[model samples]
Target: MLAGKVSLKTVRSFVLHVFVLAFSCLMIYPVLWMLSSSLKEGNEIFVNAHKLIPSVWTFSNYAEGFKGYSGQSFMVFLKNSFIVTISSVLGTVLSCTVVAYGFARISFKGAAFFFGCMMMTMMLPAEVLTIPQYIFFHKIGWVNTFAPLIIPSFFGTAFFIFLVVQFLRGLPAELDESARVDGCGHGGILFRILLPLLVPVLITVSIFKFYWTWDDFFSPLLYLTKPEMATVALALKNMSDNTFGTSWGMVFAMSIVSLAPVFLIFIALQKYIVEGISTTGMKG
Candidate 1:
């Protein structure tokens, strides 16, 4: 009977592995194809769609992309992307984490009702509020600037707050009580004790916020009128359109380069993400 059970478990594990491998290939194939296409000359790509190996891999496209395209410089756009991504990530993490603590740990009148409203904000799509945000920013003279990009992060984003609140609620209550016994206020407990334990969730939030803000095109497109203010995402979009008869190689090269950082960060923190997200559902 035990042998039969063991055999069944092994079979189940094998099937799961096979399924995972198949799905992994399905997901990874496109990335592999894109990398190959990016390295291939523009003319050869259409001709050799099935080729796993580029007939002749040329670094020229990537080289040109880095050097600059048309009027916009890739380096400048990269710098702008870094600034927007880093600033927004920091702002969102700090603001969202603190607000989440308020909802998760603190007891106040109407707290549950207000938290429900906060969650409802996520249910509404951003498209519904896009025009309203644009008009509000316009009235405040924040149009065509980074203020629209940076300031909203200070108030705290709904999704990030929700994620963090879940994770914070999962942590043991003993730590908060211990801090209280030590004469530490809520701020000290949050900053000193809880924050240390919340590392996994924090990293998870940072990874997500960084990637989303980095790749964000619409917000920058709506607000940034000047070419100098263009971010990496918008720069990529405009670079393709503006550079007529320009090298497609450079475009692909820049795309690959842009994709690398987010990929690395996600892979590094995937384990923490799984743990932090999973533990949230258990009340104890």
Candidate 2:
């Protein structure tokens, strides 16, 4: 009877493992299919949609996609994406860290009220703000320029601010008292002490900022009307042709290229994301 019980346990574990593995494969099947389609010849893509491998792989799709619209190459769009994404990430890190330190450490007049206001903004839908934002940027002559796409990031994003605030609240207030005893001012304490410890959460913020900015299509489409100024997302959108024939192969190839940076950054920094978010609610 004991031996039979052991055998039953082993079978249950085996079944559980098989179920999880199958589910994981199902979740990733679309990505696998896209990668496979990117390598396939145009005619074979839809015809062999069920197949994961191509009989005849063609790299010409990437070449054709890179040719780009007008005279510019796809490299131009990629460069634009990098510039905006990197700048936005830097701005978010700087602004969010500073604002979070204030909310988490330094007590001030109306601090609770202001923090509540900031939290309310987090619940606000982004679409509600777009029209007014566009008008404001247009008035400032920021339309048709990278300024519209990049400048507002310097103001703290509510989500990142809240994230950092939660992480900071989890730390002991004694650190601030000790720093003050050592003749460190608020700025000095934040820069010299807390900054180092903030690495995990900061990396989390940077990864999120990079991912969102890289994938943003609407902002670029609204601001960057010039072909030379188009970002990777906008350029990919332009690749689709409804009136004529869209090049499915080229679209799939460039889609693969566009996803590469986001995938690499997330994979590299994912551990920090897990660490930062997990520890956030420990105290706060």
Candidate 3:
């Protein structure tokens, strides 16, 4: 009877594993299709749409895709994306950390009121600000420039500020008090004491900002009129030309290229993202 019971348990466990594996494969099927299609000859892509393996794999798609829609290279779009993404990440880290430090550690007149306003901004949809922001940027001659894309990041992003604030609140206030006893001013306390401990949260913020900014198509579409100024996302969209037949193989190849950085970053730093978010406010 004990042997039979053990056998039954093993069978149930095996069935569960099989079910999970099947579901995971189903979810990843489209990505697999795209990856496979990217390696296929253009004429063979749709012909064997159901097939996972290409009849004849060709690397010409990647080459063709790298040769951009206009005279520009894919590297130009890639460079533009990196400049904007890196700058915005730096700006977000600087602005959000300072704002969060103030909200979590410092007390001043109207602090609560200001914090409330900041929190309210998180509830506001980005779509609502699009038109007015465009007009404002246009009036200031910032439109059609990287200024529209990169400048706003110097101001604190509400979500990252809130994230850092939560993390800071989890830290003991005694750290600041102890730093003060060492003749450290607020700047010294923040820079010398807390900044080191903030690595995980800062990394989390950078990863989130990187992913959002890199994948962003609409913002670049709205601001970048020149082909030379296009980001990877915008360049990919522009590749689909109705005048000339859209190159599916090239599009798929570039799409895969575009996903590479985001995937690599997430794979490498996903643990920190989980750690930062999970530990936030837990101590407090």
The most accurate candidate by TM-score is 3
Give candidate 1's TM-score.
Answer: 0.85
State residue 230's C-alpha deviation in candidate 2, in Å.
Answer: 1.4
| Model 2 CA lDDT for position 246 | 79
> lDDT by residue for model 1 over 1-284, one digit each (tens)?
46656787788988999999999988888888878888898888768586769989888788788876557678888888898899898999899889999999999999999999998997798999899999999999998778899878989988889988988888999999999999999899899999988887888788777878888999999998788888888877876884555566677788888898877876787775566557544111
Q: Tell me which residue pairs clash in candidate 3.
A: none
Query: Once superposed on the true structure, which residue ranges of model 1 sit more than 4 Å away at CA?
Result: 1-26, 273-284
lDDT of 3 by residue, 27-118 (tens): 99999899899999999999959799998989999999999877999999999999999999999999999989998899999999999998
Q: Which order, best to worst by lDDT?
A: 3, 2, 1
Cα lDDT tens digits for candidate 2, 1-284: 46656787788998999999999999999998988888999999999587999989999889988987778899999999999999999999999999999999999999999999999998799999999999998898888789988888999998899989988998888988999999999999899989998887888888878888899988998899898999999988887755326788888899999999977876887786566557653211
Q: Which stretches of model 3 miss by more than 4 angstroms?
A: 1-6, 275-284
Candidate 3 — worst ten consecutive residues by lDDT sum?
275-284
**How big is the positional error of residue 94 in model 2, measured in Å on the Cα after superposition?**
0.2
Winner on lDDT between 1 and 3 is: 3
Clashes of each: 0, 0, 0
C-alpha lDDT score of every prediction, in listed order: 0.83, 0.87, 0.89
Instruction: Sort all candidates by TM-score, best to worst.
Output: 3, 2, 1
Once fitted onto the true fold, the runs of candidate 2 whose alpha carbons sit more than 4 angstroms away are 1-6, 275-284
Backbone clash pairs for candidate 2 read none
